[model samples]
Target chain A: MTTQDTTYLDQLEAEAIHILREVAGQFEKPALLFSGGKDSITLVRLAEKAFRPGKFPFPLVHIDTGHNFPETISYRDKMIERLGEKLIVGYVQDSIDQGKVIEQTGKNASRNALQTVTLLDTIAANKFDACIGGARRDEEKARAKERIFSVRDEFGQWDPKRQRPELWNVYNGKIHKGENVRVFPISNWTELDVWNYIRREKIELPTIYFAHQRDVITRNGQLMAAADFLNIDEHDRIEHKNVRFRTVGDMTCTAAVESDAFLIDDIIEEIRSSKISERGARMDDKVSEAAMEDRKKGGYF
Target chain B: MDLLKFFTAGSVDDGKSTLIGRLLYDSESILADQLEALQQSNRKNDDGTIDLAILTDGLKAEREQGITIDVAYKYFQTDKRKFIIADTPGHIQYTRNMVTGASNSNLAIILVDARNGVVEQTIRHSFIVSLLELKHVVVCINKMDMVDYSEQTFNDIHKAYSEIATKLHLNEVTYIPVSALKGDNVVNVSGNMPWYTGKSLLDHLETIEVNEDEKSPQARMPVQWVIRPQTDELHDYRGYAGRVSSGSFHVNDKVTVLPSGVRSEISRIETFGQDQAEIHSGMSVTLHLKDNIDISRGDILVNSSHEPIVSQLIEADLCWMDTRPLDDSMMYLIQHNSKQTKCKIREILHKVNINTLDKIPADSFQLNDIGRIVIKTADPLAFDLYHENKQNGGAILIDSRTNLTVGALMFRASVE
Candidate 1:
């Protein structure tokens, strides 16, 4: 083995691993919220480092928005199969069928916001005391002020003003029976840091993360993948373009960036010099300046 | 390249947000979309530039109030090094937030407005940096343009701060004149400050060697989880899972499980399905012991030679975070590393008056109060002094009823 000093990536990985173990040790019933995104995939790798030679202390739970990319769902299944871990899926369609949430009706409608109800339901049904997510602080401004172990009320609501102070490396993961905590292991990692870590670990992701030929339509200056899930106007012109996804979510809301950066190295370079923030590709955040904060306070994962 | 995780202590009035905004903006870390949004917003500088503070005032309430209420972490990187800034508010009531941010920082950036040299707020921030024992301190004398770029103004503040630094025993202090609003001495060298021979803030930040690699020689790894795959292929595979907080652990090393003090030998060190002869600090790995004892979660494994002090009574300094005052009768749950146990405040020594460096005798502490207190834990805790080893010495107090973290404890010693 060659000797190399610990880099920033290693430091981040170590911190994340420590956090994962803390979740395991603190909570009785914890779940990993997986969306098959690059961030969740990174969390899966960290969970392996945190708990190996033993079945994971918790199963992976996915709150399916039902408008998700088919690639992400398939990738999620196969990855869980390979890791020999359990996966629990909560579908937004089921929540709609049960009258727990109403489906928005519009050409720009999306099931993204509706996923929070399904997620909260899934948590209560499973009695999960802690739900570990791949939320990063650098992704949004309100998230920048979040604690590593953020406590949520019985309704899964986040109170920005009433957050507990996180000190040193010591985390206090105490909650009532109904109250739960939203644990973010990668709370300190930036988008670039996540990309660099993916490169270093050679972590494989869904094919959509890399560049490929896809049918797309430009709407509000965003190149959206022309999927059936999205309400495509017949008069809208669909164009074939080479693009990759900077972030993965509901196909109706997630936008793609025009790039030929198929390889991980190329993707890193593309992200390094890219002018637009990664969340700029998402249409949901375009709704308002405080869209993310509002959703978070309303129990959006 | 390595990472520098520093804490910046200042309010918006001192141009702290402007300095941070300049660092991120000039480094090209702030993307076009964010900048475009800022430009589109109504908030702007007096001269019609985008109000950079708008970018960091994250919460809507904070934005509406024109003040920071909590600690916000921001990350930016240069070609030389990556950085994580624990940006905290510098208000008198926000001292707890500063303590929270400074606990994890290797360096402190104390922003001082040139017009108001050595103010009360300056002394308060300095006291926190000193209390946290941060080795590297950078005193940025900001708003140089407002002061007409006067070298005398900078020198006067520098001299005034030097006296404070000497009293606080802040090591490796550097003073730099900056105009965060005018982009002077922040990202690049400013032509206006020709007499200022020191490097710009960004340059100094990139080149400073914080020596973060030099962890304490004593090994400490709090056992987080146990891996016992009952599958056919890996039976009898009892592995202790934990991250090495300090020093290193190697195969055949004599180890002792803390709180139980059971002696054992390290049989194997494994990480990511590979066997390793040794694991260093900041590594997440599992170890197989030669003789399995009654080791449970929250047990710390250490080198047998340098055992941690195990005791039921602890003398510590607590920075209160909760709005509720300290109730000695209430049983608080103390979380140290992965361990959790009930604790109570046995005695209150005194509260440190941050501005005056005076220890006022007190028996109670309210929000944002820093005071020494003795704690009685339900179980014996294995730990070191906070100054000697931060990883094992720091803990958090959680209110049993509210389940909110109420105080941050930095252990001084174990008492009878």
Candidate 2:
């Protein structure tokens, strides 16, 4: 406050923290959707800023796909432990095991879309009235149209047409029984904003974010990290490369970019000059034109 | 870099989305994959360039109908500033959506078609921007190529809009001639309009000063939550959590909790991992008070000297948003900042004709109708006038039964 200058990251941080507090001020039982990705990691820090000395009014919840990178899962655990916050992870495999959701098959099939079912089931089990996400509007076209306090019906369906007008900083979390809200505190932050903010905050992430030598399969001019969770086709060839992930999702879907951005500053510089979008490397978005919109209509965060 | 939040508003087919696309495209913000998708969509123009309007039409129905139904936010950063563009729908029915978009923006881009300069939609959109008290207005006379980029046409349109700007009391209005499609004077200087020597649209945008509302004199913070770390190490901690809506607050500054009229001194200002002696507008920080006052989520902390008006009956400009219309017979929830209270419409003043800006007698209010009304809240709301201080003046009407945000209200003054 003493300085006359407040950077854009400071503005974004304040907005995100204000939203996090609104979720706490209104909802009785809310949960932070912690994916341990860069966005979610930033959200965790904002939550701390919002309610640190006091415990986070809600617990950190993760809908683990089980096919996630071991490094990401381990990093998530460590961060949660260090913050002394409770974490409740709902695995996609459990949903499959309980006959609640069918496991997808095929080489290109992924548990990414199946996360919606597991997520809704987890919400029901915990009776969470609100679930905060790290979804940014700049990532996708459909996401750009979503509200910060995205209200979903009992079936977790989004009615884009009937979305309420979000005026000023005032958010209305009013919902009847069997309804929940999916809050995105970082809806305004772009990919570059995230990297710049991460660098400024010096937040730590999994090694996957930084460059490392990993076994990857070349697919459609992109590299997919080689993992046991993925099926190796006869046409696919495994090769070792120094690559890092722009977005860390299921190994079956997330593609890595060849880079040597071992530092946060390096990643920021690379992202500044990069032409392809953050989601461009992800295989899940390449399914169709309205793929994200269609999934969101059916309650896929 | 600083952030500038702005919205684009114009009539249907006025190229609001295309203007945004052109800005992003010409700025080199468009990604390669995004361009590839646009190309593969096979929706190119007659000249073989990808129709940039398709970039913002995110929904399937929107793309199929070739119209924007809701606001699509696009982000791009130049070395000077980071911009958040709220590409809003331009249809008359979606005026509420435009109001929503403009509510959070400090500047507005009012696009006017060169072929039909200063149309009815232009007046309506300008009225909304004025009502919202946005300081900066960039009247981009779009589709200049259709008019051969004639300086005569630009001057005529600019002269016509100057009258409207004066009538609406809109300050800092800038007129630019540009063809968002032909890329004339959008990002770079155009040779078509050699008579015009002013900066291009993006140049003006990148260098223009966005007079922030936070520069207002009054400091207001509606307490959103109370943080008390109940532990042996920090047992006496009681912080009021909220964002500084305007002005600034410093340690040892005397503040009054509204409605209760309790006084307290700021003991500490706390953010994430650091403590500060002061907090400025837009900074979401926690303030510790020397005295434990009766402050809650609905209560607001205001400067004691320049306190806002506290009254149950308030006059405001109301824009009816719901399809069901405004039913004055039932109670509604007036949500102002962190506070929500039951309220009822006491009386309707008059409905303003959006096309002509004339106040006419109207008893019934329908969707997208802007009118003046007197509202009676169950409890007094401490706030400033919408024109004087936007952050403290805005409120929303939520239908008590349906729980839908039925109206957007900007407070004018206390109803005598």
Which one is best on TM-score?
A: 2
Worst lDDT run of 10 residues, candidate 1 chain B, spans B209-218
Candidate 1 residue B313 C-alpha distance from true site, Å:
1.8
DockQ per model, Cα: 0.78, 0.80
Recovered fraction of real interface contacts per model: 0.82, 0.82
**A-chain TM-score, model 1:** 0.98
What 10-residue stretch in candidate 2 chain B is worst by lDDT?
A: B208-217
> What docking grade applies to model 1?
medium
How does model 2 score by TM-score? 0.99
Residue-level lDDT for A64 in candidate 1: 88
Positional deviation of residue B134's Cα in model 2 after best superposition, in angstroms: 1.2
lDDT (10s digit) by residue, model 2, range B1-416:
78889999997689888888899999999999999998899677789988999989999999989899999999998989899999898888999999999998989999999999999999999999998889899999999999988999999999999999999999789999999998999999999899999999889888988756567778888999998888998888788999999888888988889988888888888886578878889999898889977789989998777788999999999999999989888899999999999999999999999989999998878999999999999999999999888889999999877778999999999975
User: Candidate 2: which pairs clash?
Assistant: none
Worst 10 residues of 1 chain A by lDDT: A1-10
